[model samples]
Target chain A: MLTPPETEPLTPEDRTLMGPGPSEVHPRVLRVMSAPLVGHLDDSFIEIMNEVQDLLRYVFQTENQWAIPVSGTGSAAMEAAFANVVEPGDTVLVPTNGYFGGRMASMAERAGGEVAYVDAPWGEPLKPAVVEDAFHQHDPDIFGFVHAETSTGALQPNVPELTDIAHEHGAYVIADSVTSLGGVEFRVDEWDIDVAYSGAQKCLSCPPGASPLTLNDRTMEKVLNRDTEVRSWYLDLSLLEGYWGDDRSYHHTAPITNIYALREALQLVAEEGLEARWERHEAMATQLKQGLEALGLELNPEDEYWLPSLNAVRIPDGIDESALLSDMQADHNLEVASGLGDLEGEIIRIGCMGYSARTSNIELVLYALEDALRNQGYEP
Target chain B: MLTPPETEPLTPEDRTLMGPGPSEVHPRVLRVMSAPLVGHLDDSFIEIMNEVQDLLRYVFQTENQWAIPVSGTGSAAMEAAFANVVEPGDTVLVPTNGYFGGRMASMAERAGGEVAYVDAPWGEPLKPAVVEDAFHQHDPDIFGFVHAETSTGALQPNVPELTDIAHEHGAYVIADSVTSLGGVEFRVDEWDIDVAYSGAQKCLSCPPGASPLTLNDRTMEKVLNRDTEVRSWYLDLSLLEGYWGDDRSYHHTAPITNIYALREALQLVAEEGLEARWERHEAMATQLKQGLEALGLELNPEDEYWLPSLNAVRIPDGIDESALLSDMQADHNLEVASGLGDLEGEIIRIGCMGYSARTSNIELVLYALEDALRNQGYEP
Candidate 1:
């Protein structure tokens, strides 16, 4: 017999999450997490599933019948998009602008697709001409681009133009909307995106489980007619269709509590109209950006492509990024993140997203940054 | 622009969960799920992650040092075990007796492994001689068996004997302990199993995300040195090691609230000693079994291999299985499942697991079954 390790009651410190993701979850969503469980196959739960799909369609602004929540976090949904759409022996064109694009490339490669890159710098969005050139040069069957890069805080502009290029080349387009879906302006149908996926924790103000994913009939058709079996049985959409589609059959247990949380979170989104939510995020982030600029810190992306959900600011000269972040946590119980991938050590990301995108939170972030900078002997 | 769906607030019916899984969750675990969010990489969250791993290790009864929660549900963890350990062209041996083994074969095939099966009847446990014969014929590189068959309520007895055969043949073994981990007697170390995975919703009685998985150093060595990349990036252990291992870096945003729920659930297991908890399940299930027998019902499995956590009873002649289950729910807010796969309409599965394994829940099940059966014109 093994001796059990003595573990204390779970008392995690309540943090003001202002990092790249997992921003403050809404109280309604939190309360929903505590609700009692029902079997995944319960009639009531199937109703809940229908409502979730409908809510997801509203949020993604698409009439695609396949709007559903994937079982894992945002990354699982991201992998599902690539693993289903990019078949074996196909060429997948992915952006080189940020961390998520790199992730898409890895998933595509593992899904047996040959990956080709459309080059862009870390703090910039892909230009339409460059995308056109990549399409012509690579002649890829599938193309993926990050709609809002969480790492660099750059929003891809002219989405319709990029999708147009893909359509003209007869290539399907997949959008990584993890940071932008609910908080920023995005239109899956209007933008002609074949598929788009988002994390619940970021803009939905829900915890990170049961992420949102939507696909048009055209893309799903391609996925359904794939030559090779999808490499991941769990992420394979063909099998998932039996459950999420009209059949309502068993396909593993749905995260019932997480689905409840997401229902509440999306209900909140519906109550406060989508345009209002997007405006609120932009207004809060504008204030946060101004305050950081007032502290002599430069915002990384230009206004044309700046992402309002996540504000990436260049770390001031002589400011230790790690110490600055830890000081914020130690002093204010707040969280902000350092840059990732190509922009590592060059920037600090402060998120103004979903439930965290409020005047009080933005004010707290500004005040905390000022206090930390003063302690670091930096004068503005 | 699409109009938002006028979804009602989340108010799901609070039914008693006594199905094959998602058996009633402990209130403490439910309360923990409502706790506020912290950044996934926060210092506080890192501590929570470590505590979760330690608690999982205690419940799994293994010193394997690699016990951690997969980010998704039970199936994801099951897929992870096969996707990582069974590389391309590897011959994997799986059982043909139950639904989960068929799922294993599918996942193994997706991972590029050619699958061979050891045959057994759906309601019976595997024979050691058959497993040895199958291994000798197939020269398998991996073998997988279910420790507790939820579909048929049969426990795989003589686990040490099964694992010994795999070891002598130089094959790694994976155990699906989904229905047996915390509420039944499962000794990972004593049985010398290389890998085991379970769902939080089952014997652990947490929600259906963030499942438990443990692998010994030997199997992890093969995972780490795989010539081909893991098929699913989200389930990839090598990438997950960066987050759950000593590195404590980012792989993906974990299902945070689910981890909190699992921590509290496992803490309950530690508080009530494992032996006492297992005994409680057995005692409660014994009462349930006797009551069903009094109603002239026969359990599917023989006494020698009956699984106490999930009691599979054969449906009576002329009984409408669907109506009987619905009546239990409609008349009394209770849940029990119909058999899956081979025994699909022939048996009703009543789960006694974790928080659901109690005198009251068991008594309710017996009473509800008797009432529903009486309503269906069955006598005695």
Candidate 2:
């Protein structure tokens, strides 16, 4: 028999979360995580599910009845959307501008769809002209793009135009709303995107399980009429509908505690009206951006496509990016992430989201970052 | 814009969870779920991951260093095991004895495997001879069986014999150890289980989200060398290795709270000692069984095959099963489950698992069940 670990009780370092996602969880949401769990199919949990759906609909800004929480993380919700909607032999057009777009391409290919890219450089949003040209060139069946690219800190500016291009080409549009859903302006119905998926941790300030997912009736119809079985049984939405839909039958154990935490988190979002919440994110991010500018730091994305929830601040020359991150973590107990993918070592991502999108957090981040940079012998 | 839900704070019913799964979670685990947030890739979290892996190995009774928790619930881990190991055109042999066996078939088929089954009636273990015959006939690449059938409250006997047969046939063995992992006696290495998957909510008394999965190197080799990609990107073990392995990169956001809860729960398992914990479940179940017998109730599974964690008791003639279930919930604030799948309406599933396996809970269940029976006019 193997010896058991002398593991202590979980007391993780309480860092101020300002990274790409997992922004600070609201106290109410944290409290609910410790709440007693009922059975997954318990009558009470089914009621909780209904309430979460309603709250999710509110957050997603759509009355789509298909709005529900996927049991895993954001990627699971994303894969659920792609695997269900993109049938084998279908042509799927995905963006090549950020980390999530590449992830989308991988998921679509795994679903047996031929992946084609609508290209835009990293740290920039897809232009409608390029998107339309690609749609005409590829004749794709499904088009996926990130509404807010966390990796690049770029929010796609003209969502309706991109959706219009897809609709003109007779394609279903799927939006990766992982970073934009609650903290920024997005309207599922008005935007005319057929499907959208987001994570709880990013803008919701909930923990990272039980991600938000929604599909319009048109997309749900396509999923229902799929010529091929959805590749993943765990992500099969047709069977999932039996649980999250009217039947409320068991699909899998619905991550009960995460759902509870999400309900509380989304309830917070609702209390702060969605638009008000978005403005809160923008205002705090502006404060952070002004502070960074005072330190002579350049923001990576252009203002038109700047994502208020995640700030991509470019590292100045001779500024030790790794040292800046470590000093902040060591001295300030704060979290600001280094760049991802092609932009690695060139930028740091700082987030303003949900409960974390506050003037106090913004001030702390600005103070710590400037202090760390000064320690690295950088002065404007 | 949709109106926000005027939902009150989550005050779910304070319940003593005694269901087929989701046994009463330990207090330590519950407390950890409310712990502060950390980035999924935080250094502290990586250390926690290592401790969880070590604890999982001890609980699973294996030296397999590949043990890790799959994000999502138990079914996700089960799907991960099959989708990775059972490649296209593979002949997968599954059992037809209970609910999960059918689920295994569904997953295997979705993994592009042709499913063949060794038949046994519900609530019965697969005979070694039948399994051998099926392996010979099908020449299957993988053989999966449920070690503890939660639906029927029956634990498979002679596990070594079953695994030995698969080993002789050169087939990898996957065991559904969901119900038996901690509360019942199971040794993954000793029993020669090549791959085993379990849920956190069952015998571990942890909330469901991150689930236990382990693969011996032999199984890992097969998964790594697969001809086709795993169907579910979220459950793909190879890519998952990049995150959970030495690389410490990101694959997906793990359920942070769930991992914390699981770590706390597994630590409790280690402190209690695995064999002693199994004995506690067996003893509590014995007490419950004697009480049911006194109430003129009969258990569905035979004594030798009884699963201590989930006790399936037969419904008496002329008794309303729904009334029996509803009355207990309505009166006692207690939760017990009705039968599922083949055993539906034939039995009531009573759980004596992890934190729920105390003498006090046994007394409460016996008293409540007896009272519910009397209210239904089924007096002894």
Q: Provide chain B's TM-score, model 2.
A: 0.99
For each candidate, what's the DockQ? 0.89, 0.85
What TM-score does the A-chain of candidate 1 achieve?
A: 0.99
Q: Rate the local accuracy (lDDT) of all candidates.
A: 0.93, 0.92
Candidate 2 residue lDDT tens string, B194-218: 9999999999999999999999999
Structure candidate 1, residue pairs in collision: none
The CAPRI category of model 1 is high
Model 1 per-residue lDDT at B123:
87
What's the C-alpha lDDT at position B312 in model 2?
96
Q: What C-alpha lDDT, on a 0 to 100 scale, does residue B229 get in candidate 1?
A: 95
Error of 1 at A255 (Å): 0.5
